[model samples]
Structure formats: C-alpha cells, structure tokens
Target: MFLISDMLVRIVPLCLYSHTGYYARFFTYNVIGGIAWVAVCVFGGFWFGNIPIVKNNFELVILIIIFVSVLPVVFHLFKRRSENKIITKPLAEVVEERAN
Candidate 1:
C-alpha cells in the first residue's frame, strides 16, 4: 500500500520529466531513491517490531498507526474544501458584481 501510494505520488513528476526528455536521469534517480526508501522501511519495521509492546499488540498498533497517518490527509481535504467554498464565486454573481 505504501509503495502504491509512493508510486502514485511520483507519477506526475515522472510524466513531466519524461515529456521534457529527462527520462534517463529520472529513471536513475527513481531507482536509487526507491532502493533507499525500501531499505529504510524494512530496517525501521524490523527495529520497531522487536519492541515488546508492539509485538504484544501488533494489530492495535498498526490500526493506531494507520489512523494517525490518515489524520493529516483528512484535515487537508476538509481545509481545501473550505478554501474552495470561500474563494469560489458564482459566474453570474461575478459578472453582475463586475458590471456594478
């Protein structure tokens, strides 16, 4: 799931760079970055998994971790929605206001 999300985040930049003829550099950097990312994730999980609390309550810990991670995304979505509502004006209202 993390890898999929990471790939999704990279897709836009990859497409842009590829279109602009930087595919080779992008590919090289992406490979190196991907390896480092995987290594860190694996090592971090291995280190964390050895904790007695985590091992005892693995499921609860993962659920809490997931919920915590999702909080920022939820907050961002709500914030963006509020900003859009505040900034957006109806076209007819805009035109009428402009004419006045």
Candidate 2:
C-alpha cells in the first residue's frame, strides 16, 4: 500500500478538501484505517493460520491476499490511461471554449 500511497481512495478526499481544514479529517481516517488494517492482519493470521488446513495452504492464502490488494491499483492504471487520452482533446476546441 505504501508503494501506491500517492494513488488511493484516501488521496482523493485529502486533495479535494485540502483547503477546508481537511488535515484532521484525513489524518483521523488514515490513523483509524491503518490501525484496523494492522490489527486485522496481524491477529487474524496469528490465530487463523494455526489451523491445520490454513497452515498447509499458507502460501496460497498469501497469494490470494496479494492479488486482492494489487487488483485495485492495476485497474486504476488502466482507467487513468483512457482518461488521459480523453482529457487531451484538441488545441482548437480549447481555444473555442475560452472564446465562449
């Protein structure tokens, strides 16, 4: 997640409301979410992974988690490429809009 912190659902609200004292709001959200994530992952693994079935399939579980975590980022990159192409438009269209 740190690798793509610059691009997340968290960043959108932070940037959009930056001028509205969004620091406290964003920080609170980040702290709570971070703690929840760490707690769930650490404790869940500590307890659940001890199960015979889970222990035997630990590698597969990890792979699934990694795939779920990275899926959003992969989709975001694909969407961004199409959005960039649409946003460029043409110089003449821009000049015409400014004239209006």
Candidate 3:
C-alpha cells in the first residue's frame, strides 16, 4: 500500500527533479524520507496496535485515522476552490459588463 501510494505520489516530482539535474539531492532526501516514514509507521503501529482500546475498536480507530488523514486534504481543496471563486468572480463580472 505504502509502496504503491508512494510511487504514485512521487513519480511526477521525481521525474521533474531528475530532469532538472537534482537527482542526487532528491535521491538523498527520498532515502531519508522513506526511512523515516517506515520507522514511524512501523513503530507507531506496533506501539498502538497493542492497545486495548485500539484492539477492541479497530474499525472505529481505522475510520478515525482515515478521517484525520483526509481532513487536511479536504480543507485545502475547499480553500483553493474558494480562493479561485473570489479571484474569478470580479473578473467575470467585469467581462460581462464589457460585453453588455
């Protein structure tokens, strides 16, 4: 899962950086980031998976984790949408007035 998602997410940036001749720096950063990611995820799950609450309410815990992970993404999308609307609305009205 992590491998697939990481590949999908990193593919474009990796290509762009490699194209720009930052492959060495990108490779170092990617290696460090990958190690940290694995360590955090493995240790975090090992530490948390043993908890009685998490073990008992596994589905709920998973749901909460998914919700927390998605919250920021949803917020950023909404924020960008609102910003686009604000920026475009005045310009659209001006265009309409000019056409009239």
Whole-model Cα lDDT per candidate? 0.93, 0.86, 0.91
For all predicted structures, in order, the TM-scores are 0.55, 0.47, 0.48
Candidate 1: stretches off by over 4 Å: 1-8, 73-100
Model 2 agreement with the true structure over 6-27: per-residue lDDT tens digits? 5776577777668687888878
TM-score of 3: 0.48
In candidate 2, stretches whose alpha carbon ends up further than 4 angstroms from where it belongs are 1-10, 57-100
lDDT of 1: 0.93
Listed per model in order, the count of residue pairs whose N, CA or C atoms clash below 3 Å is 0, 0, 0
What is the per-residue lDDT of model 3 for residues 27-80, given as tens digits with 9 covering 90 to 100? 999999999999999999999999999999999999998999999989989999
Q: Could you give candidate 1's per-residue lDDT for residues 1-100 as a string of tens digits?
A: 7899999886988889889999999899999999999999999999999999999999999999999999999998999998877537888998999999
Candidates in descending lDDT order: 1, 3, 2
Candidate 2 vs 3: which has more TM-score:
3
lDDT score, residue 79, model 3?
A: 94
Alpha carbon deviation, residue 77, candidate 1 (Å): 7.9
Which residue pairs overlap in candidate 1's backbone? none
The residue-level lDDT of candidate 2 at 68 comes to: 100
